[model samples]
Target chain A: MAVTKPITRFTLFGGVVVLLLCLSVFPSSGQAPKNKDLVHVEAYASHKRVNSGKSFHIIITANIKQGFHINSHKPLDEFLLPTVLRFNETKGIAFGSVCYPKPKQVLFPFSPNHLSVYDGKISIFAEGKVSRNISSGDINVSGIFTYQACNDQMCFMPESVGFDIPLKIVKAD
Target chain B: MVAVGGFLIGIILFAQVANHVHKIFDPLQIKNLVSVKQLFSAKIPEGVPVKLPDLIITTIEGEQLVLKELTSRNRLVVVNFWASWCSPCVEEMPHFEKINRDYQNKNVTFLGIATKDLLSVVRKFIVQKEITYKIAMDDQDKIANAFGGVKVLPTTIFIDNNNRIVKIHKGYLSQRELDENLKDLLH
Candidate 1:
């Protein structure tokens, strides 16, 4: 009888350890969705090669998850935060005026008023100028994209998504 | 050895209880507990009872209408600041018109003031929306600035017969909330 009691206790402890390990390895489905999963961002250059001192459009396309919409650069309301894209200044590349597409007017229940929003897929364009003295090589331009996403019911916290667009620069004759 | 086994079992049991408790409370529900008023209160001024500011705006017909002049009519006036691009403003227009219809003989008037929109677009929107209330164009945003600046679209200001700003509502208003706020104006 004494031997049986010890064996049962040892088996119970082993079962608990195995259960904990399994739980840790496989997270439950009830967990909140990660911020990155809500939107997909891709940055690309309009032209692969451009002469130095010439300007080219760098386009950033954002694919927002279904049922979610992001605010436009000009939200038209003071309370709403606008989506902004800013590029880091590189030695060989200079970013110029950033242009945002016209946003659709969406009336959401969560917002007390109408909001200018972009949903599904939207493209933002920025003009990039290669330095007049730059050599012929591929230059990588990195930028940060910030936006606030919301649905009809509620809005998620603002998130910043980083992107890198590669461009080739040719020497200006 | 026995003490270590007991401690491990206690920790495992506690974790199980914690996990179950977390599952019972939906995180989204917890987040929704924060009211919209609390979220916007940081920027939206509180609705304090004060005299409505004197302002004038041009109607779509190019006639000037002064807000203070409407005070002597011995009626409740509902002033709504909106733009054609604002979706919430469009959605609430019919509701306002409906309420206006209900109290047409109660000495209550509903006025819609369009801001930041071209008169052509405002006229087009009014025709499309079938809005019959008094529509005014605030091209210069003068009327909006006088009423403490319209930071949000679809801001409705309720004025009593005395031209006192009784309630200032910010955001998209539901039928129930509109009715509740208009209780004073109605009866």
Candidate 2:
């Protein structure tokens, strides 16, 4: 019985060590990437218009990969950061306020609170007007879009993306 | 039997140690993806003197109340816009309740406005959380629009005695943040 006891103890200890090794090698779902999931940003205009006196609207859309949601322009709470859009202005081209689409409500696991966010795709409308004094040429508008992405378990660091769009200015009379 | 007992003891000890490790590391796992400063730094545009729409809501006590009347007094009004569905808003309720109690004797009134939610839900939430403060229901979101389209839940607007909006705080507030803002308004 004394010999059996030592063997049993050794076996139990070995089993525990092996279990821990397996856990370290393969982490559980909770330890998986909460926000490393890829998010795609795409910009599209409803209609291509030559720069004219009339105002033209360009839509910028962000399409998040499945199983992820980006914080909206306005987050429900302080802990959840808001997405920001910076517009680089040109000398003769003027841009209006960037309008954001309404976001869907999401519930996080760690937090019982529901947050407003944009999952899948969100469209932001940017309207620009060409000045009458502007000559016919290609006008470039560039800006950095910043936002934080999160899932149920954790939130990822905020990412800033830069994009530029060129529009050909044409005289309309 | 002694070996089994020792193994059991080891297992228990391991579990206890793991639990402690988890507790210590759980908050560290929280990546401050976006710093709290970013949220607080969002510039609240100057308060424009636009005519605010009148909001009539039923309080948790079933009292029908008007929003403008609540602002008639020279009290520091903390109007919090939230919904029962919001997690951070619910998590911060107890803190808000404590703030209300702390400032009860002072010249301050903390009002919670339930926006984008049904009255039944708000009632159940108030009862479940044992919220003692007066919660006004903004049906049809008219009250939310009146307050410049709350845009997000858990948005708090601090108004001074003169009915001018002194500061706007967007998001869940810790007890300290609430106390600090209230102190500024009171003083």
Scored by lDDT, the top model is 1
Interface RMSD of each: 10.7, 12.8
DockQ of each: 0.05, 0.03
Candidate 1 segments whose C-alpha is farther than 4 A from its true place: A1-173, B1-49
lDDT of 2 by residue, A70-139 (tens): 8788887644457877778777878899898888887765365577898887778888777888888777
In order, candidate lDDTs are 0.73, 0.68
Candidate topping DockQ: 1
Report the lDDT tens digits of candidate 1 across residue range A1-173.
98799899888777776766775686543233455778899999989889998988889999999987888999876545689999987887778899998899876674456678899999999988887888899888899999877555334446798888777888887
Compared to the true structure, candidate 1 yields what TM-score? 0.51
Q: Candidate 2 residues B1-187, lDDT tens each? A: 9979987979875895585345323331122113545322433332322334465767667887665676666477788887765555777789889988888888678788887567777888788889988898776766666667665557788765555555666667777878876775565
Clashing pairs in 1: A112-B171, A112-B172
lDDT per residue for candidate 1 within B1-187, as digits (tens), equals 9989989877977688566444334342233234545333212242332566666767787767677777657467888987765556666778888888987887777889987677877877788779998899877767877776665567787776666665566666777767765774455
